[model samples]
Target chain A: MTFSDITIHAMAERVITYTGYMARWQPDARERLERAAFDLFVEQGFASTTVPQIAARAGLSTRTFFRHFADKRDALFADEHAVPDQAGRIVAEAPDGITPLQIVASGFDAVAAAQFSREKSYYIARHQIIQSDDGLRERQLHTQAALVEALRSGFVQRGSDPVDALLAAHLTATVFSVSIGRWLSAESTEPLATLLRDTFDRMLRTAAS
Target chain B: MTFSDITIHAMAERVITYTGYMARWQPDARERLERAAFDLFVEQGFASTTVPQIAARAGLSTRTFFRHFADKRDALFADEHAVPDQAGRIVAEAPDGITPLQIVASGFDAVAAAQFSREKSYYIARHQIIQSDDGLRERQLHTQAALVEALRSGFVQRGSDPVDALLAAHLTATVFSVSIGRWLSAESTEPLATLLRDTFDRMLRTAAS
Candidate 1:
């Protein structure tokens, strides 16, 4: 068979898990779209999958897909745009007396319990998909950069000197980046919250020395 | 004038200071080519400028330009590839009694003295040019990631535990990245070495607290 024929054949078998006849009427249309999108992305590669294909696989219309995501890349990173805003809110809500690093800790602790605890599988799948696309990886770096900015501004608002604020934000980003990296890449069963705290503590010791 | 005419006319007037008749035969062919590339990148924008333009502007052949740099992008980041190896050497040469963080500090101090102090102007210009291009910005992130890895492995080589080594390398990278950023963005005349040292000290306090 031709390569195109092989791909079409494989797609029919692969669409079983993420699609259903009644999935169009599902309550979690967003989740359905994401599942379908991920399935299509994995089968055909990110660049080869179209939005209409993803929507059709989920038994939804393209309009519904557009409502759920601005574009295919947006579908891949539905929740990332919230990072800087969420981080800013956490920073703004903290007590007036907390250290900048402690505020960073609080943000991590919050993200882990609220986001990662229930969505570990989603993150793992997303990470794998993103690793396969340079454009997605670049978008990932932009999100990380935004997180750094969010923390940096928070530190400034808390009255740290400029240079100290810089250091604090970078430390927060580093801990988050590294812990999440280890958490996702390793087969460890440790909770992300615990891993984050442990990583921050080790960073503290290194920083102190 | 039409936009195209405006661009072509502007290019004519922009090829000054970075080109000369004897520049191709002069010492430091690499420096002359870099100066020419930077001038053209700034004048006509990086995306619009070609290798031939840069070579012609530098009074050099394309072959000579190739000898100095792999591409225009490579010209923007000539010395970056040495960072990891240089950091590794510093890590290996330090006394066994030195802390991982101290080794990091030594590496930074060495780099600041050896590279940044004398080449501050080039860095400032390079930072500006890189900021304007998404591809260049992505490459910048990649370089930063490499620096993190280099320091991480250096910490491990110095006998630190895995987590602590992660922390140490990140701290080193954070300090380096932040100090350099501040040095470039701000108008302050402080040397990079001093900024780095002070940033590290502040990080230590925050970490200790």
Candidate 2:
């Protein structure tokens, strides 16, 4: 939805008030909007929340919210797209002589390090919200499919066999998905990249057996 | 959508006309409806087809169609639910000493034997449609998720660790997915179960490397 003029001015004032906080963290408008939307989703439920409310909470105009996200749901997953993008980049740039599955595993580890390390609590809460709703689950599945596609393309571009590339991509995505679930539920303070690597190793061992 | 009374009576007559055909194959009303639905879906894209058309083509009532499928999309996937049900049953009845991943692989093999062996062309066509459409892909993902859950529950029921169960279930599903895509595309006349077994072996080898 488009922003109202009044809300735009209000958001400007709110941002000015939070200038010190912004300076400390340097979180861009998109990140701020995502955090605010997720908080509202956890508080009032995804179905009950509105874009205006998220924009207001993030201290941004509806215009600024639209500039960052197409809608509230898009805002929630703005950073999620970065995982696959980074994974693709990592795979594409890896040194020669690695197998397709090795490339995928390494890419997944890179993504976990970049995106999932610092925001443990935030991700856990978001995961809970996604798990509780069918719509969110569908969105998550779509997101995952996108990642698999990206990995498959990366493998193919690296001159791997197409069929092998597909298998490696699906395998990597499956390992990443299982690892994320375990990482979210884990009681220890182990990094997500470590958990992903361990899970990938265990999965390979089990599959081999 | 519910059935009209006129369509119901017409279906009764139509069924009588097809009595000879039905007697030969002995397919139930649900199977007939699913076949008719798929044929129509292939002829006229999934979005263009209607429920009444499927029931009419199948020599059944719209009421009977609804009894079998929730909608046109449901009709296309009538046999989809059987995979998880059969997998769960196979897992539950497996002899002792099998690992969770082994059990899941066996269950997947059983499902492919029971369901995917007979309708190669039909499944290939349906897979093409599903790959082309977002809605069908989402439904497929949901179906895959359900199978993973079923496999996970089966593992837990057999006293496997919850985290390990999840990992095994996801790995099996991923292999199954990759196998099906390859099986559908293979030019040879190999059985789906064989393809699945071979793919599982290859995936294990790749993952190990």
Candidate 3:
């Protein structure tokens, strides 16, 4: 468990068991790992690619690969893997009396503005890789499901009714997902946060018959 | 590539041969297998119960179990597997001039009325099993996501905007999921269909504010 004593398998298990963190010890290492995995995934299919191969291609140790991703399947989703924690912080600190949905809106707006604004190409590539395979798409769904659970817990912590909290969580995720789909598909000058807020507002407007 | 997979492949071959011999003699093999799997899942937990054990407990072969369900994760969701086909039929034949939400409402109402109306206890058990295991719950979410895809495509087939179709699909899934949560948690004589309808209505009312 210590930095001195870790095996590749144990590191992989730890990644699966958590939204793991890495020190800012080597930021570029994360990108190296990502780029290496992306190239491997393109050369071979996702199912055929292995973590050790990715690590080797990246010129990093398997220990370093484990720090950035939960598994080989998660290497392509590094940015998304970080969203629940980032959004949860804002949800946890929102001012009182606003709706759970409103809190979720603020949380997502902050995330989109901070992270999604400049990651257009990265996300588009992820979308293509994920869409090409059924298992990857299901993994994507599970990833989003995890995000919903995080939002639901955050809303519950803020004293919303559990049912309302779950509903709000799903709404927030839908807006985030649909906005990303639009953002990646278009080459508009508008910011992702603007598209996300617009999607949230429009979804609410269209919720009724 | 693992020893376990080789064993499973050998078991599957044996099962296919055994299933044909047993089908003529064991008319209730599927039901018996389901009952055995359900009991084992309840007693030993989902992760611990294996397909071979369920087959042995049922006095059936693993092939018979596979014939009825796709895998151990799917054993508890036998009823849900039939839903997309059932609802897709209705969505495919809806009248024009109605909104996508209305199409979704009708589709869900048909599904709930036809299948979910009297299966309260069955669903409660499935919910308990699924909620107890993170993997099972994620599988359940995937099942729902498949239903959304069915709904979305059905809407698109009717010439609805793809974005509108997708948003309506998520909205419908949210309603379907929330209704099931409400239906199972409380002891009420009200039918599942009625609860589903009410939840859909209430979600729209709350969605805008």
Candidate 4:
């Protein structure tokens, strides 16, 4: 909360922004590319948009665009490395006595708390685009599979059994699905984290019953 | 248990054979393809083999080969769908009092038991081939993701929470990793089901502790 603490936190975030393997581009470049890609995808459909057109729209060279992303398909999903570390750190910092699943859910809750309210429209649009394309759906699955691996490894490092590690991964992923659905319902105004917590609470009740 | 039951099971196995999903001329076509693919993969390498060479060596036309598989890669990996239905059936038949995770582990046990006693060399070859190919590895990950979806859906239908369903799918998959590793290392002929059960037991103990 001190000015020094704030400065240190900003420096840490900036370091992660550069050093994170999941980060494919500088923030400004990513934002521009995302805006260009989303507009083209929505206007002409994802399948029809060529990489050249996306590059042109973003005002970046085709080579530069490739430098930022391995390929056009890579842009369809969020970076896996960025999400998992944040999620894992949140889960790891939770109360130790909670069940592994609960710990994992708390991580998802942290993600939801930080991103959902600010980017509701972007989330809705992105979800629609992904749903419309089989390739994108598969890519989404791949992203999710990576997230699970990251989370499971985190749990295993914490001395959990492989099964509990996997359970934590999957349970956290479910919280993701549930929160996304509830977020898109246009009926809930609560923070995304609260929706996730409620989802987990409901599951625990069901299991207890 | 009856003569009729044995007859029907044999007939179904015969149907699988006639479908040319396995090789046609070789009585051990499945075994031959697995060995040949693994050998070529280890020696000449996976990228070098053409469909024609695999067909000629197997003593079949490329058309007959296509009757069995969509591509050469398809022959290398085992069919996942071949087991999930049986697994879901086995899980569904378990005692109602068992937890969802227990039911899933039981299903994993049934499938693993069926696969564990097979030729160790074949597995080693397959593992080598897959490890050397990134595209193949991605395909395998996609297959596992599909399996997770199937398992989670089954749990969801049984009135479990979405989170619990996902957790069950992942936990079962983790036990699968443990069971497979344990099965491969043993000199004694322990049942795969027993291995899976032991893994699950250890996981539960770890969670409780």
Candidate 5:
């Protein structure tokens, strides 16, 4: 081949490699931002931490940090949106015969499996940071409200009555909150899904009684 | 009668009249503040209303407003703390044979009777103002959390298991929220107590099913 042909081929190969790198870069940046922000939040407090410091720790630009998170607080809840989606999908795909309450419990199980199973220490740290700040706590409450709304909509779309759907959604959110509180406590050793299921059963028994 | 006896009797009558006026003034100030704040909030959104404006509209000093509420937004929830107190009292006074769920439902019924029954339009307006503001919404959620904690503690004090108490508390909060939502909806004509009873029955059925 001619020298010009060889040069053009190498440049084309470099362009293809650069495109692949760009494709992977966004998620990597988000992960790095979350890790750095969490470390800072734990070391200092959530209120004391800054976006620029997080970006500096993550070896990213401030612009990149903004691209990933709306603010430092948002970094702590990076996966907040995924929770409702996971729960809703599980409810939507459950078998036809299950009660609405059961469907919601299964959704909680699915969320625990998909989002919370592996990040034990991370979640514990995040919980501490969130609990320490009023703003973070409010954001967490908002997130749960969104999840409950998603669960309610999921039940409604599946043909459950509206009030039943609302009750089941609220109940599921309550059980999830209780299970997570237990799971995050230093005294608990059980898996979150197990805790969720147990809480659900207890709630049912309490209601029935 | 002696001159000294006539003077003492006059002094006693003046003290009684002044005491009666003092007793009425505190609640009158609070009611005026709440009415002023609600009117301002409805006229020009919650965010746009100021504490001074609310106080001025009430024909009271800002100091009096502060004495009644911690802030302008607090005027909207002046009765929020009374809810848990009323509910807790009901739970504590319930009969021995009553289940935890039944006790809680009864507590909710009592609160509906004492607070919500007489303030339909006021609550409807307050709900609109709260819905329009994120900060107010967060406060409302925090208030609910506090109520849940109060309910849980009440159940625990009455010798229930901790987890069961938590579940019962959460379930009660859920039903209360649902009932309030239904009662406040534009299409609903049922009383809040009827909605609470209906919701509690539905929840029990849903759980048992």
Candidate 6:
């Protein structure tokens, strides 16, 4: 039978749509606003993009836009809130016998598998936008610090020491550097999960060596 | 036989000098600009203090003050540049056969021994400043990120995986949270080095647990 005739087709489609909602984002007013904001940010840059213009492009009033996002900078950094929850879910569900570091690595794998593929170009653009503004970069750093704190709390709940919890959280966050390296390389055919895992393993061996 | 007398005399001299320096700092010089800025920041408040007032307090021209620090905020963050070099030295000189986590922990220990004790009040004030300002807190996060990078490089040079190096660096940095906690508590007369060693031992055991 053809692939479409198989029972797995519907399940695969459901997964694709679900994951792609994370990857490409779902259809919503926020998506529309984001699209408009992204275009404005890319064209005139984050510093110059006015809220009224973004609202106009999104077919919303300035007041409505403000209801959704605090400002233009907020539009430029909309993905942060979802990341920690996704990571937490994955870590909480990892197979038994894995180390905290390994569990975090797996959490990263799940988050990346859900979000990275279609998000790449958008993320690169987002990175550029953040880099162009010192304040935005500072905010990004704050977001990361919060992420580490959240992950540390998770580890602490799992019976890790306060010190080890913080350590595991920090180590897990370091995977971002590796992810950036892989994303920027031309030969990166491997999935983000595999990249994160391999990077963690190699890093451990390197430390042991 | 007279070691106690010599130690007491040294302690008395340190108290005298520290008090003198605190008094001698004026409300207007480039040489002691950071100290003056810190004083103003603590007295009036970081956000309320202007560059001109900070320069005037230090006994330096505003331009000269600018030459010393990028801005008013820079004065509150004067320790970061020198911290990494001292930390690197400690890492390089760590006792042989220690685990990488222990090596990193020792580096912080050395830093605490050399710098932390004398500046405890300034640090507490700065910590308060950062806690009050979101921007300063973000700068602090950036400072931590840079330290992580430096420690990672040190590990990699000693032949670590780029990933694990980052993890080790991050974990080591986390000990700062615990150390800071102990420092603020006003109990625990344990040396920072001992506290860090105990922390590492505790983490190792927990990870195994």
lDDT of model 1 at residue A13? 45
Q: Which parts of model 3 have CA positions greater than 4 angstroms off?
A: A1-31, A64-70, A73-77, A92-97, A103-109, A131-139, A156-159, A186-191, B1-28, B62-74, B106-109, B117-119, B131-138, B186-191
lDDT of 1 by residue, B156-193 (tens): 87778877887787787787887888788758688888
Candidate 6 local lDDT, A1-209, one digit each (tens):
65533433344344444444443443475777788899888888988777766766665555556777998888867787667776676667767667787677556655776666665667778778888887898878767777777788877777776667776676566666566666656667766777877776655553343
Which regions of candidate 1 fall more than 4 Å away from where they truly are?
A1-30, A61-70, B1-30, B63-70
lDDT of 4 by residue, B70-160 (tens): 7778877656465556656665577767677767755664576565447766666676687677667766666666766777787777777
Q: Cα lDDT of model 4 overall? A: 0.64
Candidate 4 accuracy as TM-score: 0.70
Clashes of 4: 0
Error of 3 at A70 (Å): 5.5
Please write out the lDDT profile of model 4 over residues A98-117, one tens digit for every residue.
66675665465457656554
Give stretches of model 6 more than 4 Å off. A1-27, A91-99, A117-119, A185-187, A206-209, B1-31, B59-64, B89-109, B154-167, B176-178, B185-189, B202-209
State the weakest 10-residue window (summed lDDT) of model 1 chain B: B12-21
Interface C-alpha RMSD, model 5: 1.0
Top candidate when judged by DockQ against the true structure:
1
- Give the winner by TM-score: 4 or 6: 6
The DockQ scores of all candidates, in the order shown, are 0.64, 0.47, 0.42, 0.10, 0.55, 0.20
Q: Write the per-residue lDDT of candidate 3 for residues B73-148, one digit (tens) a residue.
A: 7777777656777767778888988888877777665787777755577677767888888677667776887888
DockQ for model 6? 0.20
Q: Looking at candidate 1, what is the lDDT of residue A114?
A: 64
Is model 4 an incorrect, acceptable, medium or high docking prediction? Answer: incorrect
For A31-115, candidate 2 gives per-residue lDDT tens digits of 8888889999999898877777787787766667787788877877777788788878888899999998777665655677677
Clashing pairs in 2: none
The candidate maximizing lDDT is 5
B-chain TM-score, candidate 2: 0.81
Error of 3 at A123 (Å): 1.1
Instruction: TM-score each candidate.
Output: 0.84, 0.80, 0.75, 0.70, 0.86, 0.74
Query: Chain A TM-score for model 6, please?
Result: 0.79
